[model samples]
Target chain A: MDMYTCDSMPSSRSEGSARSKLLSLAGMSKSYSPTVCALNGLDLSIEPGEFITVVGPSGCGKSTLFNIVAGLEEPDAGSEIRFLNKPVNKASELLGQVSFMPQRDLLLPWRTVIDNAILAIELEGKRRADARRIALDMLPEFGLAGFENQYPNQLSGGMRQRVALMRTFLFGRDLMLLDEPFGALDALTRTMMQRWLLDVWQKHRRTIMFITHDVEEALFLGDRVLVMTARPGRIKLELPVTLDRPREPDIVTSPEFIRLKRELLIAIEEESRKSFAPTPSAGH
Target chain B: MNVARDLLKHLCEALLRGALTVLTMAVVWELVVRVGGVPSYYLPSLVDVLAAVTVAPGAYVDSALRTIAETVLGFAGGAVFGVLIGVAFFQWKALRDYLFPMFVISQTIPVIAFGAVVVLWFGNTLWAKAVIAFYMTFFPVTVNTLQGLNAVDPRQVALLRSFGANAWQLLTRLRLPAALPQIFVALKLGATLSLLGAIAGEWFGDSVGVGVLLLHAMYNEQIPALWAAIFLAGAIGTLLYAVMSYIETRFVFWRDEL
Candidate 1:
C-alpha cells in the first residue's frame, strides 16, 4: 500500500488546477421530449486519469448522461459540456474523443476476437494489418491470447466483457465511459474482474467514468464515488475514497470500506425511494 | 483423419437417404400407373419418362442450358439491384415509405399477366425470359434485405457511431454483415422464383427452352416427353437452390454458432 498527502499526490493533472480537469459539465441537462427531462442541471468536474464511479437508481438518467458524453444524443440548450477545456456544441462533436463501452459487450458476432478489438482503429482509416498486429500483442494482456480467431459466441460472458474492455483499451482514448460493464456477470466473476480491471487501469492510467448499480463495485473501483438522484438525475453526493492502493480483493471487507459503503447506501437509498414516489404529472 | 471420416460418413448417410426416397417414389408411381390401368397419354410411367429423356438427350440438355442461362442472368441482375435499392431505402426513411408500397403492389401482379407485357417490351430474345425472372426474384430480395437491415441491433449502431464510423463504414462493416443471414433467406426464395419466371416467360412463343419443349409435348399429347421436360426444369431449380444454400452456409457461418 502507498499513501501520499493530497498536495503531494501523483496525478496527470496539476494539483487543484482547472487545467487538470479533462471533462467538466455545468448545468448539463437532456430531455427526449419538451416536457420530459432525463437529466437536469447536473454539474461535474473530472480530473485527468481519475477513476470515477457513478451509482444511481434505475431509470435515473445514467444512460442518458453516457449517451450525451458518447455523442449519441445532444443535451438541451443552456447545458454546458466541455472536453479537454473546449466546449462541445453538438453531441456528435464529442465523437472519437472518448472510448465508450455499453452495458452489453456488443461485439460484432461475425468478427473474430482480434477483428472486433481492432474495429475502432479500422474505423479511423488505419491499416488493418497494423491494427491486427497491435491487437494480437495486447490479447495476452487482456486474457484473450489463444482465442483470437474465435467468434463472440464462442467465449464465455466474462471473456466477452474482457474482449470488449480490450477493444476500449485499443481505442486508446484518454477518456473512457463504461456503462455497467460487469453488471451481467455473476458475483464470483464480477469480483475477479474488478481486481483484474484495477490492475489494468493502474498500468494504463486512462481517465475512466464507470457507471454501476452495485455500491460495493463503485467503492472498490473508484478513487471517488458519485451518488446520483432519481429520474432527471443530478449528482447528490461526491465522496472521495482515501484508501491506499494497489487495493486487494480483501480490502473490500475492511472497516473503512464498510463505512464508505454505509454512507453511499444511505444516499442511494434516499434517491431510490424518491424514484418510486409518484410524480406531479406523468405522461406516456 | 477422424474429422475426415466423420464428414465422409455424414455424406454417405445423406446420399443413402436420398436414394431410398427416390426408389420408394419410383416404385409407388409405377404401381399406381400399372394397377390403375392409366393410359400412357394421360400419365406416363417413370420408366417411360426416363426412356423419353434418353431418346433425345441433346434436345433436353440444350433446352435446359438455355433456361438455366436466363434464370442465372435474371437472378444475378435482380439480387444486385435489390440489395442496392434496399440499402437506399434504409438510408432514407422517406424513400422507403414512398417506394416500399409500390414494390408490394408490383408483386401482386401475376407472373403470367406480367410475362406477356415483358415479352412485348423485351421481345422473344433471352432478355424477355430474364425480365420475367428478374421481376419475380427482386421483390423477395428487396423485402428481406429491408427487414434484415431494420432488424439490426440499435445498440450495435450506437457502439459503432461512438467510434466515429461514417455511413459507408457502418454499412460495410456492421449492417451488411449483420443482414447476411436474413438476406440469404430471400436469396434462396429468389432462386426458385427466378427459375419459375424463366419457364413461364418461355410460354410466350420462345423456340429453345425447357418451357418450349413442355408446350410442344403438352399440345402433341407426348406425356413422357412432357414429364422429361418437367424433370429437367425441376433438376435446374434444385441445383440453383443447392448452390444458394452452400453460399448461405459459407457467408452466414455465425448463424449456426448462435
Candidate 2:
C-alpha cells in the first residue's frame, strides 16, 4: 500500500500546475431501504490523465460509490462533490465532460455499429455526416476498422463491447467512469481487451475511474488501486503501481506484481471475514 | 438444391397453397348455401353476385370512395393525435401518470356506443363516420406508442446523460426512434379499425357509402346487390391493410427482428 501511493503522488507541485485535479469526494456515505449502508465516509480524488481502479469484495459499495460520483444517486450526508472545483447537483452540470459506461454495453441493437459509435456525437449537435466521419476515425484507432457497418448483434460479445467503448470515447469526455467494462468478457477475451484498452488509453489519456472485483486487473490498469472494506464500504488501503510504461500481461508474472496482488487479496479477505463474523459477547 | 432454386420452390409452393385454400373456402360456401336450400330472394348464387357487380358499377364505385375517404381521414387524425399524446406523456412523468388511465378508459367506451352519441351531435354528416373511425383507431396508436417510448434501454439513457445530452436530445435521439416500432403496431391496428368505424357510421346515419347501399339492398330484398356491396367493402379493407403494411416495411425495416 505504501509503495502504491508513492508511485502515483507527485513529489513537488506548486499551485496551478498543468495536471488539473478533476474530481474530489470527501466523507461521502449512502444508505437505502431495508437498512443497508452502501458507502461509509469515502474520500477520494482523481487527477487529470490518471487511471484509478477501485477493487473490493462483492457488496462493498463499490457500485454505490460510483453512482454517487456519477450523480446517479445522492450521498446520504456528504459534503459537495467537486467536478473541476464546481459542485455537481445533477447529470446536466457534468455533461460533455464525463462519459460513463455501465456494466452492460448498452448499444442500441436496431442501429448499425457505426451509428452506435456516432450516437453520442449526434446527441451533442453534430450533423449525421460529421458524426459518421468522427465515428469512422475512432474505429481503426480502436482496432475495429472493417466492422464499422455491421450491426451490434452481428458482432461477438467482445466486439460489441469494443463498439461501446468507441461510442463512449467519441463523446469526447475529459473524464470516463467505466463500471466493469470488461467484466462480461471471457477469460481469454478479457485479457486481450485489457491490453487493447491500455494501447487506446495511451494514445488518448483521459482520467478514468474503473470499478472491478479483480485484483490483477486493478494493478494492471490503474495508476492507483483503491481497496475498499465490506458493507458500508470505506477506503481500506490505496496501492499505486509504478511497474513500467505501456503495461504488458507479462508484468503479472513478476515478483513485485505477485506481491501487490497478494497484499490486495489479503486486505479484501480480512474485510470480508470481519463483516461475516458473528457479533462478539452475544451469549446471554 | 442451390439457393436460387430453393427460394423459387418456396415461392411457388406458397402461391399454390394460398390459391388452393381460397378455392376450398369458396366451394364450401357454395355447398353450404345449396344444402340450406334458401330462396334466391334471401341469398343469391355466386353467379348472381357477379352479375350485380357489373350491372351498376358506377354507384358501387362512388360508395366505395366515400367509405375509403372516411377510413383514411379517421386513420390520419388518430395517428397524429396518438403520437402527440405519446410524446407529451413520455416527456412528463406526472402527466403520464395522470393521462394514462384516461387514455385506457377511452378504449372501454365501445365504438358503437360512441357512434350513437356522435350522430346525435354531428347529425349524420361525414364527420359522424370520421368520429367513429378516429375512436376505433386512436387508442391502439396511443397505447403502442407509449410502450415504445418506455422501451428504450436504460443503459443508453445513462450514456446520454454522461455525454451531457439535455432532455430534448434524449427525446429526439433515443425515445423517438425507440417509439417508432410501437407506432407501426398502432398503425396496423388502426387501419383495420378505421374501416369498421366508417361502415358503422354509414349503418347508423349516412345516406351514402357502402353501408348505406347495403341497407338499401337488404330492405329491397336484393340479395345479389347486398353481397356485391359486402365484397367491395372487403376489397377496400384489404387494400387499406396492404398499403399500411407496405409503408411499415419501407420505413421500419429494422423492426423485422421484433
Candidate 3:
C-alpha cells in the first residue's frame, strides 16, 4: 500500500504529476429526499489502467455513484467531477464517455449476439454491416465465435455476461463502470469469470471501477479496494492491494491475501452492523 | 427428417381439433332448432341458412366482397393513422394532453350515429361505409399504441440511452420493436371494429351490400336470407381475426420471454 491518503490523494492536483489521472471525484453527494441521503462527501482518484473495486453495505449508494459517472443521473450542484483532467459540469457532458454495465447483463431479447455487441456502434450512425464486421473480428477473443447468430436466451449465464462485457468493451471508452457484473453467476462460474475478466482487463488496459458485495472478490481482482460506510455512504477505508499481476487462483489462499481480506471484512462488517442498528430504516 | 415429421403431426392434430369443434357447434345448432321445434320465423335451420346462401350464391358473393372491400380500406387507413398518432402522443406530451380527450369523446359518439353523417359527407359510395369503419377502428389502435409505447421497460430505455441513442434511434430501434406485441393487440381489436363499422355503414341507403340484404330480408320476413347474410358476415370476421393472429405470432417471436 502506498503512503497516500485517499481523502487528499495528491495524484490529480500534484505538480510533479508524471502521468495524468484518469478520473477524480471530490465532495460527490446525492440525496433522494431531504431526510434520505444516499451518498455523502465522496472523494477518490483513479489512475489510468487501474482496476478499482468498491464494497459497501446494501443501500450504500454504490449504484447512485455509478449512475452519476455513467451520465444517467446528476450529482448535487456543488459536487466536483473531473475526467481526463477536465472538469465535468453536468452529468450530460459525461454521456457516452464511460462504458457502464449494470447488475444484469441486459442484452436485448430481440437482438442476436453479434447485433447486441455492436449496438453502441450502430447507435452512433455507423452502417450495420460495418459495425457487424468490427464485432465479428473480436468475437473469438471473447469466446463467442460460433454464437453470433444465436439469441440471448440461447446462451448460458456466463456467455450472456461475456456478451454484455463484449458490448461494454466495444463502446471504446477510456473508463468503464461495472456494477456487480457477475453477481448473478454460480460460484464456480463466478470464479472462472473473475479470472477471465482480469485477463481481458490486462489486455485492454482501460480504467475500471467495479462494485461488489464480496470481500474476496474485491481483494482478488482489485488493485485497490474502497470500503464504504452504510446509508449516507462515504469511504471508510481505502486498502491498496500489493498483489502482483497475472495472479493465479492459488494466490487467493496466500497469507497476504488472507490478511487483506480480514481487514476489509472488519471494516465492512462494522458498517453492516450500523445499518442493522435498531432503527425504522430496517423494517422499511 | 424427425423435425419435419413432428411439424406435420402438429399441423394435422390442429386441423383435426378445429374440425371437431366446428362439427360439435353445427350439431348443437341443428339439434337446438329441430328438437326444440322452434318456429322458422324465429330460428332458421342450419341447412336452410346454407341452402339459402347457395340459392342466390352470386348475389351473396357480390355483397360479401363489397362489404369486405370497405372493411379492408377502412382498416388499413385506421391502422396507419392510429400508430402515427400514437407515436405523436408518445413523443409530445403536450399534443397528447390536448387531443386525447377529444379522441375519447369521438369514441363515445356511437359509430351508428356517425354513419349517417359519414353517408351525407361521402354519399352512397364505399367511401362512406369505409369512413365509419375507419372511425370505429382508430380509437382502440391509438389507445393501445400509446399503452404499448409506455409499457417499454425504462431500464431497457436507459441501456440504449447510455449507448448514445438519440430520440429517433430510441423509438425506431428499441421502443417500437418492444411495443409490437401490445400494438398487435390493438390491431386485432381494430380488425373486428372495422368489419362492424362497414356493416353498420351499409344501413344508410346502400342497395348491394350484405347490410342491405339483411335489411331486405328483415323487412320482407325472409328469415333464411337474414341467417345466410349473418353466417357469411361471421365467417368473414373469423377469417380476418385469424389473419391478424398469424401475423402477430410471426412478428412477435420474442413475446414469450417478454
Candidate 4:
C-alpha cells in the first residue's frame, strides 16, 4: 500500500512547480448551536488543478464543511480560511470565488436548460442575450446539444446532472465544491458519469473538492482521498492515489485500485462504527 | 388534423354534458311548479325567466357590462397591491408579524357588511363598488403569495447565494418565479371573490349593474326579472373564473409535472 504525508508534497508556492496554492483551512471549526459541533480544528490545503475527494460517516459535518467553504456559513472563532493565500474575514466574501453543487441536482423546474445554465452569469449582471449565446455554444460539450429548450422535468436523472454540471462549470470559478454530485444515479450511470467527469476535469484543470460516502468513488476519482472522524469532523487520513490518469472504467478492477479501495474502506469503516455506537453518557 | 379532431371531440363532450344537465333541471322545475299549482308571481317557470331575458335584453346587457367593468377593475387593482405587499412582508419579518394578523382579521368582516361602509365612504360612484371588490380580492393574494415565497426550496436559495446573488436578485429571479403557482391559486380565488364584492356593493345604491336590477325586480314584484338578473351574475362570475384558470394553465405549465 502506498501512503504519502501531506507535508512532504510540494507546496503550490514552491518554485518550478506548475501548481499553486488555491485554498487553505487552518484550525477550522464550526458549531451550529450551543450543543452541536459540526466540524472541529480541521486543517487542510489545496493546490490548483487537483481533484480531492472527501469521505466520512453520516452526519460527520461533510456538508457543513462544504457550506463553510461555499460562503453560505461562517466557521467558528479562532479559525482561519484562506483563498488564494488571502484570508477571508467574512463568509460572504467567499461568494463567486468558488462554484458549489449540492447532492441533489437543484435545477429550477420552471427554467429551460439554456436558461438554467446561464443563471450564474445572469446573477453577475450579464445581459440575457449574451449569456444565452454563450450557453448555446457550450451545450454540445456538456452532452446537452439539442436539449436547450427542454425543462428540467423533461430530462432524465443523468441528463439533469449533466445540465447542473454545465451550470457549475459555466460559473468559471477557480475552485469547485461538489457534494455527491452523482450519488443519486444508478450504479451503471454512476460509473459512466465518473469517467465523463474525469474527462471534463482533465480538460478544464480547475481545483475540485468532491464529497462522497462511497469508498470506490473516492479511490477512483481523487488524486488525494481524505477520510474524516465520526462527529465534529476533522481529517483522520489523507491518502494520495498513485493511479495514472486518463483513467478508464476498467481500472476499478485492477489490483492497485482494489488495494487502495480496501484501505479507504477500513479507514472509513472505523469512523462509521464510531458514529453508530451507543452513547454511554447520560443527558446533561 | 388529428389534434384538431381531438379538440373537437373534447368540446362536443363538454357541451353535451352541459345540455343534458340544463334539460333535466328545466323539466324538473316545470313539472314541480305546474303540479304544485304555484303562482307565477311567487316562483316563475324556466320559460318565464327566458321570456323575461328576451323582453329587456338591452337593459340586462347594459347592467352586465357595468358590473363586469367594476369586477375587472377591482380585481386588477387588488392583484397589483397584493403582490407588492406580499413582497414587502417577505422582505421584512417585522412587517409581516405586525400586519399579517390584521389582514386575516379584515377578511373575517363579511364583504356585504363592508359594502355599506364602502358606499358611505365613496358614495354612488363606480369607485364604491370597486373599493368593496378590491377589499375582498387582495387578502387571499397576499396570504398565498407569502406562502409561495416561503415555500421556495432552501437549497435553491443557497445555490443562488453561492453565485453572489443579492436579495433583489434572488427575489426577481428565484423567489418570485417559485411563488407564481401559489400566487395563481390566490388569484383564481380572488377572481370569484371580486365579482361577488362588486355585485354586493351595487346593492348599496347603484344606478346600473345586475345587483341594481335584482333590487328593482324584487321591489316591483317581477319574479322572472329577479331570476334573470341572478342568472346573468352567475354567468359573469363563471366566465371570469374560466379566464383566470386558462391564464394560470398557460403561465404555470410546469406545475403538474414538477
What DockQ, on C-alphas, does every prediction get? Answer: 0.73, 0.50, 0.67, 0.73
Q: Estimate candidate 4's alpha-carbon lDDT, on a 0 to 1 scale.
A: 0.87
Task: Determine which window of 10 residues in candidate 4 chain A has minimal summed lDDT.
Answer: A1-10
lDDT agreement of model 1 with the native: 0.88
TM-score of 2: 0.85
Q: Among these predicted structures, which one has the highest TM-score?
A: 1
Give me candidate 3's interface root-mean-square deviation: 1.0
**How many clashes does the backbone of model 3 have?**
0
Ten residues in sequence with the least summed lDDT for candidate 1 chain A: A1-10
List lDDT for all candidates, in order: 0.88, 0.80, 0.87, 0.87
Count the clashes in each prediction.
0, 2, 0, 0
Off by over 4 Å in 2: A1-20, A85-92, A274-284, B1-20, B31-44, B93-106, B116-125, B250-252, B255-258
Compose the digit string of candidate 1's lDDT tens values, residues B111-229.
89887788889899999999889989998888888889889899999999999999999899999889988899999999999999999999997889999999999998899999999
**List of clashing residue pairs for candidate 4:** none
When sorted by DockQ, best at the front, the candidate numbers are: 4, 1, 3, 2
Can you tell me the CAPRI class of model 3? medium
Retained true contacts (fraction), each candidate: 0.70, 0.68, 0.51, 0.72
lDDT of 2 by residue, B24-70 (tens): 97787677678888777766777789898799888898999999998
Candidate 3 residues B26-119, lDDT tens each? 8998998999998988998989988888888999989999999999999999998999999999999999999999999998888788777788
